[model samples]
Target: MKKYLLLMTVVLAALSFTSCMEELGSYEYMDANEIKIDSIKGQSITQYDTLRIVPTITQSRNTSEENLEYLWYWYKSGAGENAKIDTLGFDRNLNYYVAAVPGLYSARLKITDKETGLFARKEFDISVEAENSGLLILSDLNGNANLSLLNFANIFSQDIYYAANGEYAGTNPVGIADIDNAGTDLHMIAILCADGRGGVVTEPTSFVKISDYSDLFYVMPQPIAPEAYCAVAVLYNTGMGITYDFIINNGKLHYRDFQYAAYEPLFNPEVSGDYSLAPYAILNNNTLLFYDNKNYCFNILKCSYGQLKETKLDPVPLPEGTDTETLAFDPRNVGLEMVYAAKGWKKMDNDAGYAYGIFRKPGSTDLTNMYCLRFNIGYNMSMGRDYFTPYFKHSISGATDLDKATAFAMSRQDPYLYYAYKNKIYSYDLEFDKGKVIYDTDTVVGPGARVDYLYFRPDNESFNMWAATSVEGSTEKTGSIHVLGLGRNGDIVKVDTVYRNVCGKVVGMTYKNR
Candidate 1:
């Protein structure tokens, strides 16, 4: 009885299936609109270039153009799920000015058939390249800040900050730092000023303002005063390495580590200390030396786990076999105020490099009696006191009109120190303890023209000096930027080029790499 009932159930199911198939075949069927997009391809363009794309569309049901809606948008590639999507246009075509940061992105075109409520999308890759790469000059135009660019082709773009942002960078420009290779996503140009507005950071490629100086700190200081910026490489014992960007503001030091994922601020808290710091700092691999103006001493900071720790410097012990006198002053407690400091050449096998600092006795009005202190830097303090011990201290001899100098720069390949006084640039060889005038604006730029700034390209293997000079006229000051080459013996070998009357009282300069 059970087998018979099962057979009957199977027969009934087959009959019902046949009836349903016949009923469905008796009804009419309509094809839905199928949209297809083509003719769009990946693109490679430079920043600020016009990105135009016209995608060809086809529909199986021949849908009317009026019934189709178009949308175009893009987002940075690899910025998963929460990526920032920017709308381009609502038309079938796309015309966008590529103002995005230099990087890879994905652009998409979406077409929707309003009648059928069906949509189709096509995505393609885009690579945006930096439009400008060369030297960026930050100058004080009257009282406002002006940023200019000198490209590899020798073309000059003036007031690029205003051209891109429709406003000045800030007032009282102090310095500019190109922070490349600081981290995976930390490439930027920092324009520092002493104005209450602090300063600004911009996209290295587009010159678009990223944020103000206060936005970079976790807790913004009441009054902002930015003085200097630098980036240093930090190597670990496990063969790992990273670069960190440092900024000195309000006589304090702050650092940024962008590697680890966290909600922490872009810059860490100010390095805790009671002393007022100088505007200048010397950075090397894993270490930084800051001069405390209030205490008249040098403070050492070592990098560990993305944080800076104040380290103590051991006293220098004189070598037994040599007649070299003991260091006249202790680095930790020099009784003089810091006038200037600069990084010198590094030995081939040493992780640390030589550095020089100019100092004068407290409350001393005579600059002619200033002294130079030499020391090593950039090594791990855990390697022992011998790694970065002070080398020597001596008077800055043979530098004429040292009291009148306005700017100074040190050579990284030799013991050549360059300083500008009035209209002359002199190079003092620390090795020979002598000085000579290498560039005289009385003959080159003009008589009575004053040297406003001096800098050496940090990346250049050879000495390439950048000097900014200005001559005061009855109406205004005319500024010129000269790129001069230095020979092996620390003398001006040739004038590479000169941009005359290009800016106003050039104060700071930095190189923007490609």
Candidate 2:
């Protein structure tokens, strides 16, 4: 009886163990779909170049029974909140793509197990470089309205009157201003000082807008004046949705809009005398602030997009006994686009020329005292002096030695103010209040070359400074386009003479980024 009972107990125990093992196996079984993305790297290509995306995907569970769907999408990389993701295409295999523009792009690869409705996604970044990237040099054909175009990408190639109308007389460009409207870039070439032929002084002062490749858009008439062209500044009013072309003809400030057919003068003539020098103007707080050399004061003009108004801002005071004619203002400033006037005076009885800076705030309308630059001129500098000698520097030995600041071009994006001093280019750090020689024109081009004007590339990363160079004593009225790299310290990094022996002196040069 006892043996039979023990055998029964063992049988029961074995049956129970078998049931538990079967339940455990059922719970541990995994039927969920699994996928792994093998392509997680980035890519790089030039603008308009083709890109291929070959993705390797693997499914771990029931691979043979499952069908997968693939989707590809892309958008501008680092677009942040403004990113608008666009679908590239949908296919089982997305292997091709092309970016039509230059910028960083982000691409996504999505794969879904169609049967199980399970999906996985992977993303990558791509960089597209600009295709037509380099420089466009506007030069002259020696006193003729025949301007030459020298593309730095193909430095040796030359084209004359790149985009001129045969009906237009030969006009020397006094200044070139670029305005980027929406996505289209427009260049305003101020036609002035033309020898009696193509749109000369008698032909009615005017300017033409052209596309980046020198295609003509329209020719607009400027105020008829015998005054030599001083400067041309182009700016867009975001508020009123207007584009303004401000021109200084023989010291008078006049403006015209693309929407209008006529040019109009700004401010009343009773406020001051003829603006003697080119009006140095800049955009500040959506208003235009300019320096009036005749009055030796800074003035402000505002545009609401439809009409213009003057701020009635008081003029920055000039130094006592300093002739307003001897003072020149650099339109470029470190911050807020304020006006900085440089005045140098070497009295007939004195051997040294005293130079100093006068500053005004962007929106200030008070005529009270203007801020003065209390710093030294040369290597060694101390605080508190409102002026310094332009010619003599302690480190630059000799009498009547060292170049004085001649022409000025302030980096629109940096704190450094560039000036053509003594035939060389020097950069002055407004923050550090120190000056450094960036390029030696005597070495880059030749001695006796004068930089009539300087243009800094609006996009600062290129480290480029374009100068319109003219030789003082050259028999032929010729000029050259000098390109200098502003990246390195102490000396200029890259120097290229894009065009030489131009028929006429280069009065102005600017870059239009494509």
Model number with the top lDDT: 1
What is candidate 1's lDDT per residue for 1-514, written digit by digit as tens?
A: 9999999999999999999999999998889888999999997776788889888899988756888999998887767899899998898778889888766688889999998889999989887756786789988888778899987557888889998999998898899877665235446778888888788989887789999978888888666888888766532211233456677788877877644545333766777767778888776555556788888877666556445444332222324453334555666578788888888876444446788887887877565678878887745542234344677778866777665689999888998889998899999886566889988987887687889899887755567899999875422437889899999898999999988888888879877654
If scored against the real structure, what TM-score would every candidate get? 0.69, 0.54
lDDT string, candidate 2, 1-514, tens digits = 9999999999999999999999887875667788778866886664555666677778887556338777888887555788798887777555454555555678888888888788899988865544432343344444444444443244433333333344332445444333333212332343444342213221101223232211111332233332232222322211122244454555565554444424332212222344443245433223344555544444444444334444233333224565534433322122222234332222112112233343444554332323334222221111111222222111211111113444676553354567674576777654444566666667756787777667665433356777767776554645666777665442467775545665355555444332
The TM-score measured for candidate 1 stands at 0.69
Model 2, residue 404: what's the lDDT? 41
Q: What is the lDDT of candidate 2?
A: 0.47
Off by over 4 Å in 1: 1-130, 234-242, 259-265, 305-326, 382-387, 473-477
Quantify all predictions' global Cα lDDT against the true fold: 0.76, 0.47
What's the CA RMSD of model 2 in angstroms?
12.0
